[model samples]
Target chain A: MSQTHVVPTRVYYTIFAILMFCTYLTVQVAFLDLGALNTVAALAIAVFKAVLVVLFFMHVKYSTRLTWVVVIGGAFWLGILLALTMTDYLSRAWGTFG
Target chain B: MLPDAVEHHHPALAHQFDSLAQQREAAALGMWVFLVTEVLFFGGLFATYAVYRWWYPDAFAAASHELDILLGGTNTAVLITSSLTMALAVHSAQLGRRRLLLLFLIATMALGCVFLGIKGVEYYHKFVEHHVPGPGFEFEAAYARQAQIFFSLYFIMTGLHAVHMIIGIGIMLAMFWMSWRGRITADYYNPIEVSGLYWHFVDIVWIFLFPLLYLIGRHA
Candidate 1:
């Protein structure tokens, strides 16, 4: 295990702390009047935070490519599910229907 | 053996697995699957939120403003700390630091309790203001039923996440006791690591939940 695992503990934690602070900044940015860009900004920061969790906290950085595929595959399928469902759900023309 | 001592898989494998590598793979894979399900589960709520936001944008925004940003932000920080401790707990197990393992487990559990306690306080605030949405739930006339829908989803989504937190605390408590008995170690720490996975996934869920429930479109 020692021979194979190369990243030091401090590096992992430093990145974790950095990602957390970025998340905090994203949260604080919500208080400002960003108008139409508010959701976009929060979600962009969220994706960054999710990447940090996946890479470091969950050891994806140290995991095999196969493992990364498994993890990413889950995320991909989730996106598909969300996309298909929301297309139908959101596109319902309210007053157009009799 | 206690009832909880159901099976360890094999004597050569700590009665929990056919082999160390297999046990590790199974535990990690199982957690991934569970997390996928959770994604779908919470995805439903997120979809509902988006749909409702489209329909009742003002009401949803108004109700979101009612959420105490202090509690939400503090809870986010608290949960991130707990995740840090949880990752550290797994690291201690990997390094075979038995005492440190217990310490981190206790620390993680304590942080989890703080999260639930804060959430309980938030729920109490909601209750005092009649934010709990249902048949008798009160809503200002401007909202009609839309604001109530927002609160209904809020309670259900956050309430379900809170239930996961309580279960997470229980898992950590059990692991703490097991650690006391020398059951968890570098070689046989799959369960510990898996519990950390669950805890971290829960933390990740809240990561998104916080932004969606509290932060999205609130800059009006």
Candidate 2:
């Protein structure tokens, strides 16, 4: 018989703390001059925070392999949408900004 | 019939499902599929924002600077806390702790409302500043038109997110009613778990939105 996994409250608290700290870090890092890296830093932090939430808060870590497939598949498709669109726009030479 | 009675069949288990576990798994998988569609829906907007921001980096940065980071940051914290409470709510439901489940759900909804209230305040400030992306909309003469595009994407993206939050709150209300009626249990807490997934997904959207819209221009 298969049993469901129950996460401990302690883990939840720990994740919550980490997320809050990251939130603080992201906001603070925005004040510094990182040039092109500013967007990179912000997006990187955002991605980290999002992964934490997905694994812990969304219970994807404890989920079945099939669930993992669905989650990763979604992200993969989003990547396709963004990547394909950006490649076209970035490679083109436009005369004026809209 | 005798075996079913001896097995103590649960009412929550639908006829098609052989067991409660199967039902739970199916429900979760269904919700994840739904969320995938949502990811793509919002992905389109993010892609559009990227293209425009790439084209008009200066205007995007200048417009992004107009956003109140403090309020946006506070809303991020609030939304994250709500996600925690929501996770806790699911945990409580898993453990069959009815009271804690209800409490956490209420706490989550309250935090959700607070986030919206703060968002409303931010929007009002934008309106007062003539930044709502319409004819009356005003900005620096250099890039006023591009800035309008920024605010246009801002309202649409965040506006759709706000709509999702409102829908999430409505779902929580239904969950609250279900729990209050003693419909949820350790063996049949699919609704709460699915609802939590939706809530967390919403939080994830904001996780990206806060930085993209509010922080991208701070260093500039």
Candidate 3:
């Protein structure tokens, strides 16, 4: 039987601490008037926290290449969904809705 | 004795799989595929939300202010911590530590319940404030209609996410029961690991949800 790579407990704790810190940062940043950057900053922090969870907690970091393909393919498809839909919406004339 | 009777078979291993590693890999791959579908399921709503929020920034921002950051932020921490416990649970199972595995699984479920409890409180506040986005819904007169759209997306997105959380807790319960029965051991802990993936995926959805629903419009 092949041995599975065991993630150490301290690694979990460290990831938890970083997630908590990012949560605090996102909330605090939200209250500041950074104009357009507000949305950017919030999303950036969220994406960072999500990557950590996906990599460490979800074990995708140690997953096989086939697993990586599925994970990345899923993300790529989501990007298509968001990007294509937004391009059409943003390009339309405002009067078209009314 | 029959020749076949001389071979010992792992109860968890199916006849088709050559080894435990192959079985575990197949299980993990299948679970990830399911999660990929879930991503798109939630992604459509996210796309809808982005378009509307862009079109009606002021109304969306004003509507978002009604969400209490304190509660939302706390829930983010709660869910993330639950993810940690879940990872630890999977780790314990890998080590064949049944008692620790059970402890961490229970902790993960309790935290999940806490998150849903907080969500219920927030939803209650929404109802009390007439933010339910239907006929009786009310907001500032100018932004009322667009704000209702915000609340509508809010309810649908977070509501879907909450449903996922409830399902995640159910999955954990099964894991707990199986572990209690000693069905899960270091040699075959695919169930615990796969379930952790589901739990962590739910947590990741909230990781994005908190900021999009609660934080993005805060400064406006």
Q: In model 3, how large is the Cα lDDT of residue B54?
A: 86
- Cα lDDT, model 2, residue A79: 98
Over B67-142, each residue of candidate 3 has an lDDT whose tens digit, in order, gives: 9989998899899889988999999999999999999999999999999999999999999999999999989999
Q: Which regions of candidate 2 are displaced past 4 Å?
A: A94-98, B4-6
- For model 1, residues A21-59, the per-residue Cα lDDT tens digits are 977798789988988788878888887887787777777
TM-score of each: 0.89, 0.97, 0.96
lDDT of 2 by residue, B116-219 (tens): 99999999999999999888999999999999999999999999999999999999999999999999999889999999999999999999999899887686
Q: lDDT per model, in order?
A: 0.81, 0.93, 0.92
Can you list the residue pairs that collide in candidate 3?
none
lDDT (tens digit, per residue) of candidate 2 on A1-98: 22678999999999999999999999899999988888899999999999999999988998889999999999999999999999999979755556
lDDT of 1 at B113: 94
Superposed on the true chain A, the predicted chain A of model 2 yields a TM-score of 0.91
Model 3 agreement with the true structure over A2-51: per-residue lDDT tens digits: 68999888988999999999999888898899999998998899889989
- B7-61: candidate 1 lDDT, tens digit per residue: 5344326455556776676677778777778878887787777788778888888
**Where does the lowest 10-residue lDDT sum fall in candidate 3 chain B?**
B1-10
* Model 2 DockQ class: medium
Candidate 1 off by > 4 Å: A1-7, A94-98, B1-19
Pick by TM-score: which candidate is best?
A: 2
Candidate 3 accuracy as TM-score: 0.96
Residue B62's C-alpha lDDT in candidate 1?
78
DockQ of each: 0.47, 0.74, 0.82
